[model samples]
Target: MNNTISSVCLPKTYTYDVEGQRVLVALTGNPFNYDPQTLYSLAARRNKKRGFLFVSKVLGKHVPVNPYVPLLAGINLGAHFIEKIHGVHQVDVQAVVEAVKKNEQTKEVYARVISQPRFVLPRETLFIGFAETATGLGHAVFSLFDNAHYLHTTRDKIPMLQPALDFNEVHSHAVNHLCYPENPELLKTSKTVVLIDDEITTGNTALNIIRAIHEQYAIKDYVVLSLLDWRTKDNRGNFRKMEELLCLKIRTLSLLEGEIDVSGSSYHEQSPQNLTTDTENRESFQVIVEEQLLNLQEVVSVFSVDVNGQESASPYLKVTGRFGLSSREDQDTLPLAREIGENLKPHRAGGKTLCLGTGEFMYFPMLISAFMGEGISYHATTRSPIYPFPKPGYGIQNAFTFPCPDDEGISYYVYNIPLNYYDELYVFLEREVSLERLQPMLRVFSQLGIPRLSLVIASPVSRKTEKR
Candidate 1:
C-alpha cells in the first residue's frame, strides 16, 4: 500500500498500512490547528473487534511524552468546552491552542498557562472520564474547570460499594465499565454532564453511557468530548436519534473530526517474545521503596475482589477522582503531586528518568513527573495490546509485556521504552502488591539495564523488601 502525508490543515487525508490492513483517514475538521502526526499515529490492534488503534502521541498512554504535552491538550479541550458553553469570544481558545502548539518545541509555556486562573463554569457540571485510557485526560480537562464534579469509570468492582452506573465499551478489550460515586447526590443533581474519552470511533460508547445515565438520572444536557472524532454521518445520526428519544441535548467536541476507512483481511498474530530473558544481572539492580509518602492519604478500607476472589485494595490517595471529587478536592492534586515529587527528588540518579503509572492511574504520575525536574518522560501500562513495529513513524517500536502487578492473570504492556535510554525508573502503583507479583515487571526493567528502580506505592501497608 502507498502512504501519503499532508500538511495539518482542514480536508487533509492520509493512509496507513499496518500489517497488510489498509487504513485511510481524512480530517474534515481541524479547527484547533492540531497536526495529525503530532496528535496520534495509526497502529493495528491485537483484538479482532477493532483492527486499528490511534496510539495517541499526546495522551501519555502508549507513548512517553513530556507531561506538558498531554496537559496542554487537556487545557485546549477545556478552553474549547468553555467556548461551546459560553460564547466563543468568552474564552481565549487561541491562546490555549498556541500553548498546545508551543509544547511541540518546549514545555516552559505550560507553566505560564497553568498559572492562569481557571475558568469558572456558570453552572455545576459532572465530568466523567472513561476508564483505563481517558482517566488522566479526563482529569486534565476537569482540572481546568473551577466548578465541576469529576469521576472516572472503573473496571474493578469494590466489594462494599455498589456501582451508581454500569455501561460497556463494545470494542474495548475490557468491555464492562462501572461507576462508583462516594456521594449518590452527585448524579441526582448536576445539570450538565460531560463525557470525556481520548477518541470517538463510532460514538456508540458515548451514546451507550448517555442512555444509561438518562435512564436513571435523566440528565437533560450532555456533551461528548474527545481528541479525535471519527463518526461518520450515519454514526452521528445515532446521536441525534438518541437526543430526540431522550428529549435532551447532545453536543460533541473534538480537536479533529474525520472519517476513518479500514479495509483488508485480518492480520496474522505473532507470539510475543520473552523480553525478560536477557535479565542476567537482575539481582544486581537496586530496589528502593519510598514508604514515607504514605502520610499523604489513607487507604480505602473496601476491598476489590477479582474473579478468583482475590481481595486487593488500592493504597492510592482519594484525589484520583475515582470515587468522585469536587472542584476544591480536585485542586488538591497539584500540591499532593508536588510533595511526592519533592520526596522522590533526592533519590534520583540525575539522568533520564521515566515515570510509569499503572493502569487507570496516569494523571497523577504525569503531574508528579513534571515536578520531578527535566529529562523526564511519562506513560502508563495498558491492557490494550497493539502490534509493535520497529520502524520510523511507527507508534509502538518496542514493548515490554508482564503479568499485571495488581492481577497476575491479566497481561499488561508498556510500549516505546528504548533500551539503555533511562538511568532510573519509577513505577507508581495505586494498590499495594506483593514483591512476588511485581517480579515480572521488575525483571523487565532489569533487562532494560535501568540500574535504579523505585517502587512508589501509595498504600500505607508495610511490606518486607530486599534491596538487591
Candidate 2:
C-alpha cells in the first residue's frame, strides 16, 4: 500500500477559498484504505477563529445520510479500538468499508453485524462524547462496549444540576461544555475514560478536559478517539506534555490522520439572514404532532429548575446520556426506537422521507429513522454556521436559519435541504414545543415544499398544549 503523504491516488492537496480566506488540507495518513472524499468534504465555517470545517458525509449532521452509516462508522471505530488496545480483532474493517462505500445495503449490513453480542471490555470504561456535533457519534461508539458508561457534554444550563466538569472549545461557536452526570461515581470508578468526538484538530479540547477530570477524578488511562485526527507535530506534542504533567496514560486514535494548514487574512462575514417566507403552497402542507409514545410509562422524565429556583417538570429523556446512561439502558433504547418507528411508519406519506433531529438530540432520531423503513434519510439542526456554496464537492449546498424551537434565544440551522427533495419530513425534538415556537421551523419546511410534516416529541405534557 502506498503510504506517501502527497500520493497522486488521492488528491495531494485541496484548497478552499471562502470569501477571501484560504484554507488548504493535505492528506498525511489513510491507513484504513478508505477514500478521504467518501468520509468528508471541506466547507468554510462562519466563525473567525476556525475558518474551515470538515463536514462529515456519514456523521448525519451537516449532510443527510443513511442512519445506519454513522452507526457502522462507530462500530468500525470501536472494532479498531478493541484491536489496538486489547489485541482482539472483533469486526472486519473491510466489510464496514464496503457497506459504507455506496451507502446501499447498509441497513442489512448493520443489522446483521450489530446483532452479535457486544465486546465485553476487561475494565469499566467511561465514554464522554463532545457536545453538539459528536453527541450521536459518541453514543454510537459507546454502544459497542458491553461494560461502559456514556455521557455527552451539553451547552444547556439545567438548573439545580451542578456540572461535574466544564471545559472550553476555544474555536467553537459555543465555547462552554458542561458535564452533568447524575451519578458522579461514574467518573471516579471507571479505570479507563474515552473521550469521543467527530474530529480532533489541535487536541487542546481533549487535553483541557483531561486536566479538569484529573483534578477531580484522576483516572489513570484516557483515550481520545475521533473520525478524523488533524493534529500537527507540535500540536501532538502537547498531549505528551499533558501526560507527563498529569502522570497518566494518553492514547489517540482515528479513522483518518492528517495535517492541515490555514493561510490568508481572516474576513468578517455577516451572519446569513433568515430568508424563509410564507409561500403560496404553505397551506398545502399538513403538520402533525405525535405524542402517544411519550405518554407511555416506559418514557423517562427528570425535573429542571429555573434561574428563579422554581422547579419545572422536564421532558428530556434520561436515555440521551446527557445525565449519564448505562450499557443496559443504552441497549433498552433500541426497543423504544422500534416502538416509535412503528408508530410513525404509517404516517409516512411517500417513499421519500427525512427525519430531522434538533441539535444534540441526534442519535435517537437516527435510530428511529432506521426502523421507519425504506427511503429514509437522517440529519440534524446545528448551531455551527457554515458558508453554503451550491457547487459540486462542497458539503453544504444550501442552508436554512431558524430560532431553536425549544429555545428561541439561540439560532439553529439546517443545511442541504433542496426544494421538494423529500415528500415528507419527521422532526424529532427532545422537549415538547409549542406551535408558536415552531412556526419559524415550520415555515422553512413549507418553503421547501415538503407536503407532510410530523413533529415527533419524545416527551410531552400530560395535557395537550399545542394547537394548529
Q: Which candidate comes out best when scored by TM-score?
A: 1
The clash tally of candidate 2 reads 0
lDDT of 1 by residue, 344-438 (tens): 77778857999998999898888888888778889999998777777878777887788887777788889988877888888888777877988
Q: Flag clash pairs in model 1.
A: none
- Which residue pairs show backbone clashes in model 2? none
RMSD of 1: 4.0
* Per-model TM-score versus the true fold: 0.92, 0.91
> In model 2, which regions exceed 4 Å deviation?
1-6, 9-12, 266-293, 296-312, 463-468
RMSD (CA, Å), each prediction? 4.0, 4.3
lDDT of 2 by residue, 169-216 (tens): 998988999998888788988899999999999998999899999999
Name the 10 consecutive residues with the lowest summed lDDT in model 1.
Answer: 459-468
Candidate 2 has its poorest 10 consecutive residues by lDDT at 274-283
